[model samples]
Target chain A: MIENAKVCLYPKNPGEVVRILEQEGRRALILAGGTTASQVRDPGVTTLVDITRMAPPTDALTHEDGEWFLGCNLRIQQLAAHAGLKQVFCGMLCDAALSVGSRPIRNAVTLGGNAVSVFRWSDPPVALLAMDASFDLVGPERERTLTADRFYSRHPRRILKPAEILKRIRVGVPSGRHGGAFFKFARTAFDLAVVDVAVCLWFDSDICSRARVAIGATRNVPWLSTRAARMLVGKRLEGKSIRAAARAAREETKTADDIRTGREYREQMVEVIVRRTIERAGDNALGV
Target chain B: MDIHVNINGQAVAWRANPGENLLDVLRREGFASVKRGCNQGDCGACTILVDGTAQRACLLLAGQAEGRSLVTVEALGTPAEPHVLQQAVVEHGAVQCGFCTPGMLLSAKALLDENPSPTYADVCAALDGNLCRCTGYKKIIEAVLDASGRLRK
Candidate 1:
């Protein structure tokens, strides 16, 4: 409830959005999907800039030159239902999108919202980081691109300027044998994840050439387990290597006690989910 | 602010506060079927169809409803001739407290409209957002399946 909002502007394009944000400064809020915006109680917010109308009307997902571009304004459900993405990365993105809230919530929640809000329980960031996606940001100064690593390095809000907007996400579709899997452990299907894991692997023949292991809901922000990923590279996707990688992920992650679970329990589950996700990703890569 | 929307096949213009949510505005305009349950999005009590897609009204600002088609449970059926889903719920004893019925019906309608022949898993997934505190989900699931069959026939 943006209590002090006295004006809601429906911007027709990015230029208009930037203009409004620049003019209103701290008093303006960007409303995308409104899932997060509806909960705003900030008394300082006096203007709402609605961006739904400015989103790309069609072809939410486009592929060109081996890179996939995802419109930020696309709904989570749309991403879940996208046939192109369903086939990409062994449908890991679809799984993450489907794992978001329920059907109604997914219908209203946008991909940009999920990415920008940066909640520990947010599902897409974990997968996006694992996939090494990049973001195209539009601002009053000039457009800039940031890798998922850099984008999620700090709170996105802190990184983004007042008038900047996340416009599109780009990921290179791996051409060779590659697969990814995302798993979220929650009390219920619709509950916020207690611990979530996403693993993406590229295999050179029977050997793992590259790997990415990302975990969320355990830290302030979802982060890539580089040590765990390093453990998988140059090793065969076998029991010994998988366990070692999972152990690294467990050790690298620092969990805290929350209302949902304890720190030790989360640490234990991280290892389990990481191992299983890696196995699933291996099977996906092999088409087994 | 003035926001215009097509509600239940009628185009109407209404005054809305910039901060007001669609749920409050809809109910204020006499759309009593749109319940104000959790105020938060967890409870699907304020579920409505925005552009034929089921969305929680509480999550949408009233200004965002402009230039969109909105549907409420009121458009589904009348007491004289209830919608097939409504009729099936009553016959299958799915209505207990009936507090979650409207939301359940709307969610079910959205599913059946898209998938005329849905399996048990599909119905379960569709109603996952709407919680039936009366613990009558089994009957409700049964009713949705039955209604899908009836609608197809």
Candidate 2:
């Protein structure tokens, strides 16, 4: 659909994405995964550099004491398939990856791209946010680390500059009593989410010590329901706490009248999904 | 852009648009077997094996296919001496109207390459992305499983 656009395939690395951006001097588009980028109309665009190989490093998944490192280039598919990471998170990442489009889409769409682009329907942002994920960033102003919350500062409006390149995504993998789960509701088998909920529970026995409930597809970034998480910290997740947390999650979001679902219906569905996912994550603590 | 790609075991060159999907480019170059049904990536009628992995040719940019080994329906043996999968499909009566056969074949080929013995569930999972308006997709699933069994032997 785009005219006068030239694509440069086989970018050697992610840095090349930055270099070409610099060389093109803001006139061209730096395209990685070309899913949404190709669809847009950028009049100044003359070149489109494909960034499939420009993915970040997959060098380490080490654990020192408690901190865990997840490589940025780790494809959403790759993250789902890693047996070690899956064992720790218990299908949290896998659920997110499986929730996206079909096989070929998953095969090419990287985790970093999903996060950097920050589409609300995208899974990584909500799942990673629930687990307290951080990013190792590389930019013109030297390299630094930014938490998922800080990395996504625009609450209701999701937008990012072209110059920022995400190097790696880091998370403190849940250990001991922590467990996580993600649930997405779409119109059909493969479609964007209307409303989704992800839960990460740190329960020592039946008593929940800490918890995080993130609502997705209803907000710009993953809306971490601190009130919902707090309501469950001291109580059990089975009965009253579930109802209260679900209520808090509902109050935290303000949905619009989209074709997917009505504003009232989405708010109601959010409560339902939150309660269900939280209970499901809590059930995992029993290992039953 | 001028690009060279290995098409069905032979190197074929084309002066292509980098933004163009590989499906149109391949079809233009007379690989008639690579069906073009859906311009969108959903329908698997344009599926092809790129670097031994099944991918939607409609979704991939022509420039992205460079340096990759591309296998399309043309590579499979003809009706006179059909590939084992083609034979299985015909025997199982999997082709009806048959707009979706080429992509189905590539999906089957990619799965068989990865798993010589795939269960019925595995076959369904591999072909989930590929859609068919005819044959009810029942016989096609059976054909893939049947081919998997034959290849395993």
Candidate 3:
């Protein structure tokens, strides 16, 4: 229960939001999408500033050559409906958006707020990390864009400051024959991932040319299996290499025990999900 | 302090206190359709459309809803003249114990509004957040599809 809380509805403007926060100082909690209740674990959160009514970006999704610019308010559901965005990210947004809690949660949920929360049991961070996505973060200082990968490194421990606004996320369309799939396994179907695996596999015929697999819900931040990915880099999509990579992934998993599952078991499940997701991805890549 | 919000289409002032969620505030103001099931966002029982998008009112502060158009279960058609989605559910015999019906209907409405022609998977995705213990929810899925077809014209 919140105490001495106040609900302040400032108009939807970036400068206004910043100004209000600056004025309120530590008393204000900028609530966007209302989806952060699951993400934020603050007991002292009493006052809320609804940032939902903020005006949409006064711009279009300008595609200069190949690169496209998506606004912060460009919701994941809208992104799924968009024909252009569907083909580029290879159904990552649709997959991520569908699995986030429920329909009502997704409806109000924004793409920007997800990254800002920086929870392990999130989908966008893993999906964005896989597709080389970056965010156009607007803060009190100025506007700057940082790679989502860099964003993860910057805040390896916890979330970034509230003043730093996660403006817009930019995802580069995948080039060449890249096959990817994200499979998350949890105790309850809707619960947080016991172990979530996202595999982006590049293939040269049946053999893997390159692969970037990022696993979340296992550690503080996402655990990128660089060693495991290296094991499968040049090897044929056959028996020994797959098991070896799975082993390395299991060994690397530092999943702490929680109410849902044990650490040792979660580590084993990571191997199982990694093997299965990679196998499915490999099959799709091989057209088998 | 009081907040000005547009509930459904009409603008109304909500005397929301601190710690009062939009769901509770709506109930206090005599809009009792917004069910308080789990208090957590996991249950879709407290679902409503904030700015035409389905969201868990339980999680949203009344302040966040200020200035935005909110569509509770009341916003949809009534028993005498039900909305298309409501009519579809009735026609399909989708109401069982009917605890999750309001949320389910709102979820369907949000889905149909967002995507007029969603596939079967889209319908399932729309109902992901809502849980009905008594009913199997298969009929609800059919009802949403039926509503989608009816709304297509």
Candidate 4:
């Protein structure tokens, strides 16, 4: 049981939420979708603050200045059904959202929870990391945006101050020719990922302009393989280049033994999945 | 705190602890249809329809259900007048142990409510959360399809 449990507060607005957080201080626990309780080993929480009401009443998905603003309260099921996301984000959001847990769980799990969850199975972060998504944070003091890397760089972290909450996620639509793919290898379709890979590539005529390869469940944090990504720049996305990049990703990735699989097996799966995801993305980008 | 929610279309009030889960509160309120399986979101035994969407009650706090509509398996039908899906389950011999039936029925109901005619893949996706250790899922899928066919007419 939650020791010293207090009343759950439903904040009407961002400012109200901040006020509650500021007043409660360390005792306040922000409950987005409430799925994190089961996974949390010891939730030294006192007060439960429900921020669902703090969400904007309008559309969760909006395009402003070439960037898409995704509300933090948008549930995974809504994200999967989002037509604009499916059209622009290259199905990564849908794939990741659909890949998380089961249909019932997905109905309640919010995109913000997935982004901030230390649980690696919270699938959207890897795909969002590859897509270079940034988070909009609102605190008692001020509001700012943090890149996905900074937001997820530490364990059990969201880069939010005690009274801060993630407001929205900003993802810039990649211009020109580009494609992306998210591949998760798990025991079952509903199970957590043993190894997951997300790859996004931009093609300039015959040469690849840019690439982002992110491997998840391989480390404490989802890691972007800069070496692997750099290997594809200015080179044709062919078998040789893809193989080198995948190998680089495998080399750069850090894995540890877990209940899911062994370290060596995860490393090997990472290489295999990274290669497959890159090839899939390349094929999609080339319209093949 | 005192929380009020619409359960099975009836407004009810109950005093709940600050962090009490909806599943526990529901089971205590005699809604035994909402089972307690893994207590985690992994299992669908505690599945219920919250505002027409299938969700696990185990993960949701009692306070979160305030002023929202909740439908447990009890709302579907009684033994005399079983829901069409329940009738199909019986006709197709879909209940082996019957522990997971409530969740499957609710999930299937949510799916059929939205899309009356669902394909095999759609049915599989809808019932992905509800795990039936018995019946091997073949008869369960067939039962859902049969219910869909019956509902259409």
Candidate 5:
């Protein structure tokens, strides 16, 4: 239904993508995977800048100086199969990748698009927030890096200015005894998450040294409950600590009634999901 | 605009609107095997092999597919000479309405091309996007597994 669009501009690189973004400004829509963009009938978009053509070489996963650099266009299937990612951030990255849509959808969806498109139930953004991933932004005026949490703070729309494109995402490899798990609660495997949770816990022997807990589909944005995460620090991930953190998560989340589920139901499920995810993360940390 | 792509190994030219997708363009070219169940990507009835990878044609703009090799269910085998997978699908009684067959066959073809041997779980996961309302999926999975065994022999 995206009729009368002027052209689907093919940019060669991030700089060219930025230049096109600058030229068209808000009148242009950047097409990454086109899963969401293609279906839109945006009367405002005169041009569709197809950024998939500007993709880096197919082998886009690279490790440099301990940080994992992923091309913005790397398909979800590629990200899921990435050996290095499987080795380090196994459960969190792969599980989120596998959670998105289905096989053909994953073949077409990109990790960057999943995060940058501001889909509330997007699996990767929540997992990336838990992983503390940062994005590389290239703009006509400036280039910068922002943490996953900051990049998604605006919720429904990406924080990128009209002339900026997310070039890549850089993830710092987590050190120490850390375990992460991503869970999506959907009616079926192909359905979008009614609610999802991601937990990354760092433990020093029996004590929890650090924690990151994120929840999606229950708020305007997928949120990293920093307060809840902080509550788990310097404590063992036992029943008492988990209950406190789960209570904090439910308290902090902003939920609303929607067609799929009710506000109270989501709020109630938040406590349950958080408690279970934290316990699963604890088990993962112990290699159990 | 005019875009040229190698569809089913033949270079072809077609006129497309700026907003037209590969699904529209292919259907115009008489590749009816590329069915259009959902213009949106949710339904994989329009699935086709783009560079040996199964991708939804609805999600790909005709311009995005330019200069790339496109494969459709038409390339697999004709009715007179059915592909191994197509034959297996018939033998397993997978086709009920038959609307989801092309996409299912292409998805299974992509998987078997990469992994000649796949577990039942892998077969199910590969065809997850292609929905079949008729056979309830078990027969489709069995067909793919049966085809895999046949391809090996």
Candidate 6:
């Protein structure tokens, strides 16, 4: 799709990447894992700034100051294979990462590409939304961080200026009887999700202290259902509370009929998936 | 544009376009083993090992292969000295029509390289990307299992 491109520059550092993007303006495209590059059909793109060699290669997952930092360049497979991340939030992040297309797709798709290209079927955003992650961004002028809620408020490509790059994703590791779960319902193992849900719960002596319920593929952007989450706070994670939260999630999420499934069916499945995901998270938190 | 890459352990400089995909470039360079099944990322017919990880060639830009080490199914083995995985596939009748075999073999090679003794589920997960309409995957799975055992010995 980048058939009209003229130059492909391998930038050795983020600064070089920023400069090249600035110099090329709309003519330059950043190529990380390159899995989605084939989808680019812009006729104006004439330069490709490859960033695989921008940093010293290391494990993309790192823990610092009670938070997990996922380098934007991290491949989806690397995120899925990280033993440390597998233990985080009951392996919700790993589950979401592994649910992406397939092994080869995961091997080539970067977390940054997945985040920046906000497709409706994207998986990691749902988990990140539920985890309340933050994105670190670097641009020609400054570097800043935005919460996942804000970062995903619109297409990340729109949020990022022409020279801006998503540097890393920061997710706080929950402590003290917390658990999370991600459930993706797809037509096939490799097909795009019909409806996906992510849930995180914190408990204090059997009472739900905090909760986050995020749904994806049902809307243009994945979103956290505050009303659904509110139903769980201060209530025990029993059948009654879980059902109420699931019902709220289904009601609040506005789904549209698509080629994959019907709107009413997706809305109904939302409730089912939310309840199941929350129940799984509750079980994980209780070590059941 | 010119890109330098280590292909099957041999360093080669290849001419390519910035927007062209790796599958077309490799095929044009006489690497017939890298088949083009689905130009999109959905089918893994063009699976190749980039820096020892299996990735789709069709989805990857040719420029992305610059400075990287790549291994296609051509590097696996010859007919006279077939790789154990190839031998197992032949013995298990896994090669019907043989179009997806190259991609499947590379995916399997990647899995076995990382985990020599992969479970049935591991093999399935590893080969999930490469779809085969002929074999129905039963023989392919069995062949991979047999090859894993032979490699362990």
Model number with the top DockQ:
6
Candidate 6 runs further than 4 Å off: none
**Tens digit of per-residue lDDT, candidate 5, span B4-92:** 78989899877886577778888888999899997778778999998899999998877677677889999999889999999999999
What digit string (tens of lDDT, one per residue) describes model 3 on residues B88-142? Answer: 9899999988888899988888888879998888899888899899878788999
Per-model C-alpha RMSD? 1.3, 2.5, 3.2, 1.6, 1.6, 1.3
Writing each residue's lDDT as its tens digit, candidate 1 over A1-288 gives 777788789987887888888899999888888989898889998888888888454227898998888888889999988898888898898999999998999999999988999798999889999999999999999999999999999989988988998988998888888989999999887899999999999989988999999999998789999999999999889899999999999999898999999999999999999999999999999888
- Global Cα lDDT for candidate 2: 0.76
Q: lDDT, candidate 6, residue A2?
A: 86
Which pairs clash in the backbone of model 5?
none
What is the clash tally of candidate 3?
2
Candidate 6 C-alpha error for residue B90, in Å: 1.0
Which lDDT tens digits does candidate 5 get at residues A156-233?
A: 255777787778888888888888888888878778888899999888888889888989998767888887898899
Candidate 1 colliding pairs:
none
TM-scores, all candidates, are 0.97, 0.92, 0.87, 0.96, 0.96, 0.97
* Chain A accuracy as TM-score for every candidate: 0.97, 0.89, 0.85, 0.95, 0.95, 0.97
- Which residues of candidate 4, in runs, are more than 4 Å off? A1-3, A38-44, A156-158
Fnat: each model in turn? 0.73, 0.23, 0.70, 0.59, 0.62, 0.86
Q: Candidate 4 on B69-119: residue-level lDDT in tens?
A: 999999999999999999999999999989999999999999999999999
Residue B62: error of model 1 in Å? 1.4
Q: Write the per-residue lDDT of candidate 1 for residues B1-153, one digit (tens) a residue.
A: 888899999999898887788898998899998898988899899899999899999999887888899999999999999999999999999988888999999999999999999999999999999988886589999999999999998
> Tens digits of per-residue lDDT for model 6 on B1-153?
988999999999998887898888999999998888878988788999999999999998988888899999888999899999999999999999999999999999999999999999999999999999887999999999999999999
Clashes of each: 0, 0, 2, 0, 0, 0
Off by over 4 Å in 3: A7-12, A38-47, A55-63, A154-162, A203-209, A283-288, B87-92, B114-122, B145-153
lDDT per prediction?
Answer: 0.90, 0.76, 0.74, 0.85, 0.84, 0.90
